[model samples]
Target: MPTHSVLIRDQALVTRLLQQYLHLLKTYPIITKSVTSAVLSALGNLLSQVLESKKKRKDGQSGKEVDVYGPLRFAVYGLVITGPLSHHFYHLLELLFPASAPFSLLKRLLLERLIFAPAFLLLFFAVMNTLEGKTHSDLQDKLKARYWPALKMNWKVWTPFQFININYVPVQYRVLFANLIALFWNAYLTSVRK
Candidate 1:
């Protein structure tokens, strides 16, 4: 049971934190977004592991040991790949499809759904396969089995989000917005990889 004053204080603190974060974004956009993505990606992997463990327990099966490396790998990928790639991609999109351009929203959405999404998913699979220390043949097999399914799912889940993100969200905050969405997305990705 919290009092009204406590809630007010909490809100104020949150506001201050958000302001500081914005300042950081303005001052150090790439680094801030990268670190944020890394943290969220790690958390997503952890969330997936926790859910899997709970499911196993519910099924009266002994839970497997947590894979410490999984979250580490996700964090690295987010920091090195996703953050920078998204930062550049969104900037490029804005450059290519300025809002005043005819059918800008539709063009952006189509490009993202058709080109970026599939390529990004393929990159994700390749990178994760490499990170997992799988050989080239194994990577090829994974691509054959999982790539199409994941791309289909990605189209289903992300098309609407990308539409909103491209059309509505401010440019500076796009990566952060995507990162927040990727928190859940990463969890699903981790499960799919498993």
Candidate 2:
């Protein structure tokens, strides 16, 4: 919002902070990507509130303490799932093609689909089916019953929500988008619960 405009106007300060933040993440992805992303997001929010209060004191602003447990839980998800997966994928891809670098989401997704998705999907399904004691009939039944439902849900629900976020692809919006994704995952898991 205003922060980006402010940063754009005062490029020096924002640029310095952004570089520092990037360095922190690059250096300590295990910790920084998990905690720093959440922390920075929260602090960015708090700062916005503070500024709003200063601008319109009579409008009644608050400086309430946020419960950081939610962010911490999100951090755990980021660390265990997103961070390590990205790191491992980077290393594995580097070995496979030392000269090529992924520059865009399309490139990265294409690379992943070409190199990793098939192998990972096979291993993943094997482990899942084994653990769940899925017979051939059961697996077929699952594909028949669940696959279309999941595809429909992704297209009808998640895609619309994602498109809304995509409309405003600002840096602050990205953090909020991540938070919304976490919210969606929680809601989906709860829906799937028996």
Candidate 3:
């Protein structure tokens, strides 16, 4: 009986804490989103490192050790770039194509894929290369090698995801939802980056 009471108290405490956190996130979207993105991107990079290590081991080679700096790089990029950019992009997208009707969702999806996805993917690749100290020629070459394939893959994954996101998720919760999915997306991006 005492244990049951303790469990109940703990559950209630957790619920209250979660509520407070959500309230804070809503009140300060940019800061919260940046922190969330930084954490998730770091985690994603770590996951990628783990997977790569495992693959190397399975291939009968010494596993490559995970480098702390790689994930740190992703965390910084997420904090400074992706978090704020994605938050504002979603807000503007919603304003331009308010999902008031059924087809409006499709419209937003089309606009996002047709316009935003290509442009953002290009910029993301370019910025990542530049930050990694790639010269202009190297950046252009990397983009040529990776951009279209990554964009194609992005369309494959994000098209349906955005359909649900734009139509179903509330405005305030949209970025949070996307950030949750982005854990896996970022992991994939890290692998692709290599």
Which residue pairs collide in model 1, if any?
A: none
TM-scores of all candidate predictions against the true structure: 0.96, 0.37, 0.90
TM-score of 2: 0.37
Q: Which lDDT values do the candidates have, in the order given?
A: 0.91, 0.46, 0.84
TM-score winner, 1 or 3: 1
- Of 2 and 3, the candidate ahead on lDDT is 3
| Model 3 agreement with the true structure over 9-124: per-residue lDDT tens digits | 99999999989879878799898888888898889889889998999999998998888987888788789887898888888877887767567877888888999889988877
lDDT of 2 by residue, 1-194 (tens): 56887877789887898888678756765565445444433344344444444656556655345444433443444445444454456555445544344444344444655444445333423433444556877656655555445444444554444434433343223333544454454334222311
Query: How do the residues 1-194 of candidate 1 rate in per-residue lDDT, one tens digit apiece?
Result: 99999999999999999999999999999999898989999988988899999999999999888899999999999999988899899999999999999999999999999999999999988888889999999988888888888899899999899999988999889898888888988889988876
Weakest lDDT window of 10 consecutive positions for candidate 3: 97-106
Give each prediction's root-mean-square deviation over alpha carbons.
1.1, 11.7, 2.4
Residue 171 C-alpha lDDT in model 1 = 87
Runs of candidate 2 exceeding 4 Å displacement: 1-10, 36-74, 100-111, 114-194
